[model samples]
Target: MKKLGFGCMRLPLKVKKINSSIDMTKTEEMVDYFINEGFTYFDTAYMYHDGRSERAVREALVHRHERQTFILADKMPVGMLVTKGDTSRIFRHQLKKCGVEYFDYYLLHALNAKYLERAEKLGVFEYLAKKKSEGRIKKLGFSFHDSAKVLDRILTRHPEMEFVQLQINYLDWEDEKVQSRLCYEVARKHGKDIIVMEPVKGGKLADVPEKVKELFALEHPDWSPASWAVRFCASLQGVICVLSGMSDMAQLKDNTGYMKDFEPLTQKETDILKTAAAIIKNEETVPCTSCRYCTASCPMNIAIPEYFTAYNKRLAGEDYKLYLEERAKDKGKASECIGCRKCEEVCPQHIEVVRLLKKCGEIL
Candidate 1:
């Protein structure tokens, strides 16, 4: 397998708000293409697409191909566990949902300081160790979203974790809030291989500012901006797999085309990326990563990520009127935000979502 893993979070959807409305035909085609190209790793979670992501994997890949031909990874939703049995219940449910007898890689999903405490209290690590000993899970790890200090503490306490999945991209490598480099160093200190998520910063780096695009074009006119972002993450030491949440065929093709013959970015290209990151930071756009975790529990049926994407486009001087109109036609607009701040609580980036929505109401 190449160093690229297929991320099953943002699969093509037929409807806007419904997670169960996955476009299975397109997804199956994409999966066939990916596997035919010799990439086998796939990563999904319990909460992704409201539990339909695992089911989609069953339909698209597991049922069609021999299980031995692909490597499957799934996560236990540690953040949502309120009782000791919750972990076991969710794990069993995930196995049935994905139609798998054993997982190639199993993770404790979305661990931060608070979630880490809860996991310890709930004996989540002990449970994972038991599962691994039983041969149900080949490898155990965790996906993290926290500061470097917290990461160090977690790794020191749980040295058994095999790998650490992190949000590593050119834009967030040195970001004060993300501290991608700091977190990565902490993981390496514990001798863990890295699985990179959000290598494009939720597609923001793919649709970069014109100035940054010009810089990239001048240097490597043949490469797409997304290729640069993915290559930057793959170039890092100890990175084993870079996950791309491909939503369509074009993205899958572009990603595999470059990653098939992977090459580390040159020193000149790395410096250019640093300059581009600085330019992006100065834009001061809302730093929403579009994980869509906020929209799952929303009461008003607001499409928070879509609104943020449109608002960011407007900030980048792109005409967003038509986009805003279309979004409003299908889902609640930003003006409909009720100041409940539910979205802000779930946002991994710690984005002030309510304030940003208010600003989006004004501008978009």
Candidate 2:
């Protein structure tokens, strides 16, 4: 199988609204082009694109293509569980929504240390394993977001999980909070196959600092910034696939073109990435992956990611004042945050929502 997977989280949206529908026509074209390019892995979660990613994949990929040609991966939103029966209810709904009887790869989504404990108490692992046994799911695993110590515990406790999905990229590789490298080592230690998510760090690495750009130009001027980020993950041992949330045809084309015959980065290239990480780390603030987990239940309906993107732009010395103004229309401004902390609870990045929103309010 190819090392690249299509992540459905950042699929193009039809509108700027929080609960806006997906742009289906463009998505279908992306799906066709991806399959035609000899790439088959497509991953979606229950809450991706406001609960529409699965159905969109159903219309764009699953419904239109031969099921045997592609690999479909969907995740159980373990963070959304309120009762033990949630595992059963959501699983049945996901099967129906994706227009599939069985999933090629299924995982419990966003397993932080706290959620991992909750999943155990609620019997989520047992439920998903039974589905796998019953042929409703071909493989079962989890996407993790916590530290290495917590990860070691979960992997030790649930040895039945076939693979582990991790948020990995050159930028976050050695991040003290994210611990991408440490987590990768832990997964390898447990002998679990790895599915990499956020290889481009939610579009952060794709748009790099000028210093990093000069360094890349010195090495591989032909390569796009995204190519370097994605390749970094694919080159890692035990990484079965690197998932990129390509939002448009250009992105899809660029990703598929480079990954068609993937090459692992050499020692010198790896050293360049290490230096780039140090430069990016100093400039980064709020480290939001634009996962939009924080915006899902925002009482003020703030476009949190958009504001953060604008803030990052301003810090990067890019023009963002007008852009921020436009995004603030029909959406909650940074000043509207009530400090309820609801968004923080669901946030996988461990960002201080109230605090950051306050900062965004001041500048953006």
Candidate 3:
């Protein structure tokens, strides 16, 4: 385990579906490359890739490799839980889907203030503890997406949680809205091992603003922008692994190449990133992670994530019209949002999807 985990959320799409159609051939290649390079941690969720990601993990990694060689992690879909019974049912279902008898890591998916309340009411944590006790879950944890106060409360109540998955990146490290620093400090204070997600801020920091890019260049000329962001999270003290949702061969190679022999950032390099974060903080960009959670239940079938990506690129002064056109080919334009905020409800980043879609379509 080289502190780099393969996130199966954004597996290469085989074709354009409202959700996604995973290209298994390329996914297998990515998984094999990752394992061959000595990385084993793989993270998937119940709703990732429209609930098909776990099966894809089976096909791409689990079926091909020996179980002992890789560590598989899955989460209970907290948003979709209708009853305490559903937790047990979905856990069993996930085991069958991933073709495994037990999960190396099991989590309460997207544990936030709202979900935490619901999960407690439904006895979700207690059920997971039973699973861990039964050997179905090796380690119990939750992926958090709320404030530090909420985190402290949960950890205090549920000290049984073995680890925590947090969204950590240089850009959001000190952002008031994200509260990455605060949440991270809370996790550290609890004495928990941390698995980092969104280290590159959903690819936004990978293609940063010119000034920010230049700052990174001056610090490490050969390092890619993504390398700096990923390494920033990996360099942190308690981060057990930094998960990158690599979508293609290029991203896979780039991430694994840099992480093969990991190094921590020196004080001066950390200072440069601090300067880079200051410049990025000034940019007015949509804070979407392209999670596609918004489009999961969109009545109009809008390509919400794609629209936001193009809009962000435009804010960066790049050509985005063609990309927008391609993204809107068979899907609803952003103008068709109809003011329904179903997207906002499930979005981990709390983006104003309807309003941002209106602006993105206006640009088109």
All candidates' lDDT scores?
A: 0.90, 0.90, 0.89
* TM, every model: 0.81, 0.80, 0.80
In model 3, the number of clashes is: 0
lDDT of 2 by residue, 73-190 (tens): 9998888998999889999999999999999999989998889988999999888888888999898899999999999999999999989999999887877888999999999999
Superpose all Cα atoms of candidate 1 onto the true structure and report the RMSD in Å to 1 decimal. 9.5
Where is model 3 more than 4 Å wrong at Cα?
A: 284-364
lDDT of 1 by residue, 1-364 (tens): 6899999999999997577799999999999999999899999999899779999999999999999999999999987899999989888898899999989999999899999999999999999899999988999999999999999999999999999999899888887888999999999888999999999877777877778889899999998999999999999989999999999999999999998889998899999999988887786677888799999877887878888888888655466767767766778778888989888788899998888788777755
lDDT for residue 191 in candidate 1, whole number 0-100: 94
- Pairs of colliding residues, candidate 3: none
**Model 3, span 1-364: residue lDDT tens:** 6899999999999786544689999999999999999989999988999889999999998899999999999999999999878988998899999999999998999899999999999999888888888999999999989888999999999999989999889888887767899999999999999999999887778877778877877867889999999989999999999999999999999999989999888888888889888887676788888878888889999998888889888665456768878777899878888887888899999888887778777664
Candidate 1 Cα misplacement greater than 4 A, ranges: 284-364
Ranked by TM-score from best down, the candidates are 1, 3, 2
Error of 2 at 163 (Å): 0.6
